[model samples]
Target: MDKLTIIKIIHTVIWVFFNVVLFYLLYSVLINKIDKWVWICIGLILMEGLVLLLFKRMCPITVIARKYSDSTKDNFDIFLPNWLAKHNKLIYTTFFVPILILLIYRLISG
Candidate 1:
């Protein structure tokens, strides 16, 4: 397979991994299950946020994928629907921020 395709697959996998982490975190919060796993998920998400900030809000894999393709689509480096790829960050952040706030509430109220 081509390098761009490989990057796209890898990026898609990473995206899915984060989705699982975020959802699990939400579940943990909902159930008041504050544990190491919750902290781990928060750490992983923060690390990803730091990496994106360092890269000027772009995934490093996306930057590498640019070396192999000239596509102007938002999903040029990921295997996702075009609209999803274009708004993925916005969509996830919308859910994520609320999950985080809820988590904080659970922690403080308990």
Candidate 2:
């Protein structure tokens, strides 16, 4: 309906897209289907990490969303629960790193 709302919606879409890609990469690694797509997914995630760093450890979308509304709700920018959204990076990295490391080890040893 408004510019900020549209931007918030776009931000949420991108946030969801990032998680979808991350999960798909995880699925590929777990299924032993790591291939070019997996590398591409990793690259995407790295770029996201870079963006996070650039934004002072906040997602660019989240920063942009701050200008839109001051809802202060966890799901304001993304579709995650309050607690999960707050700890998304830590939780995902905890799981993602080990799996990715194991997959990379398998790749390297093969």
Candidate 3:
């Protein structure tokens, strides 16, 4: 594997890892797991979203990957399915937003 391929693999691994943590934290929030840890996770998620939003919703690794290759194929930097790669944010946000809202309610009420 070349440097670009190695970087792509690292990017894919990090992306998947973050997603797993996000889902786990979101699940914890849904199950009424209220505490500093939940809030910390929420903060991390929001911060990450803000950073991505600043970059037009593209991961920094995606920008770097473009410099290495001109492939327009889906899953260029990740090992995800084409559909999942395309709709991952929409899919996760579907659950995350509401759970976040509930988290806020819990925080405010307590």
Cα-based lDDT for every prediction: 0.93, 0.79, 0.77
Q: Please report how far candidate 3 places residue 3 from its true position, in Å.
A: 2.1
Residue-level lDDT tens digits of model 1 in 19-105: 999999999999999999999999999999899899998889989999998889998899899999999878988988999999999
Error of 3 at 25 (Å): 2.1
Model 3 scores worst on lDDT over the 10 consecutive residues at 21-30
Ten residues in a row with the worst lDDT in model 1?
Answer: 87-96
Q: Candidate 2, 16: how far from true, in Å?
A: 2.1
Better of 1 and 3 by TM-score: 1
Task: Compare the candidates by TM-score and give the number of the best one.
Answer: 1
lDDT (C-alpha) at residue 31 in model 3: 79
Off-target runs (Cα >4 Å) in candidate 3 are 108-110
Tens digit per residue, CA lDDT, model 2, 1-110: 87666776786678778778888887887788878988888888888888888889887777777777788776677656789878888987787787689788779977
User: How many clashes does the backbone of model 2 have?
Assistant: 0
Cα RMSD for candidates in order = 0.7, 1.9, 1.9
lDDT of 1 at 42: 91
lDDT by residue (1-110, candidate 3, tens digit) is: 88678877887788777677677777776677777777677787778789889889987778887887887876777777878778877877786888778778877876
